[model samples]
Target: MIKVGDKMPAGTFTQITKDGPQKISAEDFFKGRKVVLFSVPGAFTPTCDAKHLPGFVEKAGDIKAKGVDVIACIAVNDAFVMKAWGKAQNTDGKVEMLADGNADYTKALGLDMDATGFGMGVRGQRFSLVVDNGVVKQVNVEQKGEFKVSSADHVLTQL
Candidate 1:
């Protein structure tokens, strides 16, 4: 598993937001800015919907105040689902919701989990990374079904 101080892998993915489809690349998103990216197993899941994503949404402003350029949420779902989930969370313009539909980025980062028994093929483990200039400054990966270190408050403290 990747850890704190590791450089972020180069990757790209497309996402659909309230505006439209947008293609995002690692360089464009995190190369020169401070980014706090959180990945979840899936969108609309209980913990993701109720806690993970919402926590980011609630602290997006405070995070920016601390010099974060972007607060992004990534999940192993399609753009439509990501978009809808963002809307449902009332995070239409606040958080940038990205879809890793094929788990390309997730696998590259060595963060993919096999949840076949539960019907999810390959999903991203719940994790958060602080990226500065394309390098990972810190990483917080949650243990299975736990959401402590990856919470927004926890990352804020690190900041």
Candidate 2:
């Protein structure tokens, strides 16, 4: 799994914007910036939609006030789904929703989780990272069926 001090791997995520869908590269996104990247098992899941994503949206200003350049939420759903979820969560100008549709980036970070038993296929585990200039500064990976550390409040303390 990705840990503190490890550099973010090469990867790409699909981001849907007002213009259209755009391919966002990890390099360009994290380069020379302090980013708060959070991942959810899947989009629109109970915990994710009810708490995970909403918490970040509520605390975005507080987080950015601490020098975070970007705050992003990633999931193993498609760009269209992510865009819709973002809208539903009212994440505009707060959190950037990134779609890792193929699980490529999640696997690259060693954070991919098998949810076949749950009929959700491969998904990224619930986790959060504070990455600065492409290198990880802090990491919070939640245990299965738990939402303790990888939360907006917890990350704020870390920052």
Q: Which RMSD values do the candidates have, in order?
A: 1.5, 0.6
Give the Å shift of residue 106 in candidate 1: 0.6
- Decoy 2 TM-score against native: 0.98
Quantify all predictions' global Cα lDDT against the true fold: 0.88, 0.97
Instruction: List residue ranges in candidate 2 displaced over 4 A.
Output: none
Off by over 4 Å in 1: 17-20
RMSD of 1: 1.5
For candidate 2, lDDT tens digit of each residue in 1-159? 999999999999999877999999999999999999999999999999999999999999999999999999999999999999999999999999999999999999999999999999999999999999999999999999999899999999999
TM-score of each: 0.94, 0.98
Query: Which residue pairs come into collision in candidate 2?
Result: none
Query: Candidate 2's C-alpha lDDT?
Result: 0.97
